[model samples]
Target: MRAVAALARRSVRAGSGRFLVEGPQGVRELVRYAAPSVVDLYVTAAAAQRYAALVESASAAGVFVHSVSDEVLAAMADAETPQGMLAVAQQPEPTLADVLAASPRLLVFLQEVRDPGNLGTVIRAADASGADAVLVTDSSVDVFSPKVVRSTAGSLFHLPVVTGLDAEATLAEVASHGIRTLATEGEAALTLPHVDLAGRHCWVLGTEAQGLPDHLAAACAERVSIPIYGKAESLNLAMAATICLYASAAAQHGTQ
Candidate 1:
């Protein structure tokens, strides 16, 4: 139980090549999408009953499903209030070559993004917007962290996320795939609507506080800014990323 709870720590997850998936939503998706990676599933009796279909799916995948007491579930979960279900799953290994090989039309490149919630929200938005993949630099937060995985709300398992990349080299490689790279900046002369998003492109986003550094912005083919109409100081990083991704989605689908 102590070892299971220790999975919440990044060092433990890294060393073990495993991470915890909490709640019904995350566990359900993990079973449905990445079932082969599931190692052990722990659930309370009530959760097993409530999420019977889910448990059945996990069992069918040959996952070890353990029904433990509520106290045990609490000890194994990372959430303040245990969601009654949790799972230990192996981490996925995706590469940049894999992403490029898919001929991705639209993509997102996150540079040094530090906030776990913001990173998770951006990943969820990318999935919702039909992004081919999410390329994350090593400077960013661990996408497999409990906060990030939970915040993704199961979108984490929906799409491919290639991590541990060098920011500049990644941008160049994606560009080599014939995808235009657009940096999201507050002061860019080009606004969102003016940019041609109907074609293959990648949106490069920055950190929560500092945003993209000048050199990273220069590396991209273009820079864009999301206009603020109201008195608000600025848009949140996740909200900005959502707007950017959805814009490309709309353009690609001819809905814009």
Candidate 2:
């Protein structure tokens, strides 16, 4: 219990090279896609019974399973209402070089995005939209944080998520591959529909509060905006990213 609780902290997860995946959805996905990295799984008796197949899968993959009381499961979990299932898995470390080598046509670059839910949703959206990978600047929230992991619903293990990147260096590196960087802003002259989304490109998103920095926006190949048709003053970062990513997906696939 003490060791599992310790993994909740960023420092501990960093030192241990491991992070927690909470809830049955996240755990099921983790077990299904990343079974090799799963070290241990904790489940309540009820959860074990309800998700017997998942537990069996984990066991077959050689992951140690611990059946504990609900109280005990809560003690080791980050959420108040433990879902009766959690898994500890090694963090994947992928480099920009590795992502580039895959020749991804669509990408999302998060700049100093501090909200875990927002970051995770963007990753999920990226994966759903068939984006090749997701990149995060060093200033962004820890990608492996509990909330982020849960928000991903297992998409975290589906794609290459290169984290701790230098903003300018990554921009330059992707540019070398003929990937156009499009900085999303509310005030940009070019709107989403106007931008050319058919080619290899990357959508650069900023923090929730500040959006993208002016300097970074200027550095991008194009500064684009998503049109607001309703009374809402602006779109949530995650919502905007989903729209942009899907727009790019539709365009690139010629389904529009």
Best by TM-score: 1
Across 43-151, the per-residue lDDT of candidate 2 in tens digits comes to 9999999999989988998889998999889989997766899888999899999999989899999988898999999999999999999999988899999989988
User: How much is the lDDT of residue 169 in candidate 2?
Assistant: 91
**Best model per lDDT:** 1
Q: Can you write out model 1's per-residue Cα lDDT over 72-176, one digit (the tens) per residue? A: 999888897657999999999889999999899999999988999999999999999999999999988999999999999999899999989999999989999
Worst 10 residues of 1 by lDDT: 74-83
After TM-score superposition, what is the CA distance of residue 136 in candidate 2 from its true location, in Å? 0.5
lDDT (Cα) of model 2: 0.92
TM agreement with the true structure for every prediction:
0.98, 0.96
TM-score of 2: 0.96
User: In model 1, which regions exceed 4 Å deviation?
Assistant: none
- Whole-model Cα lDDT of every candidate shown, in order: 0.93, 0.92
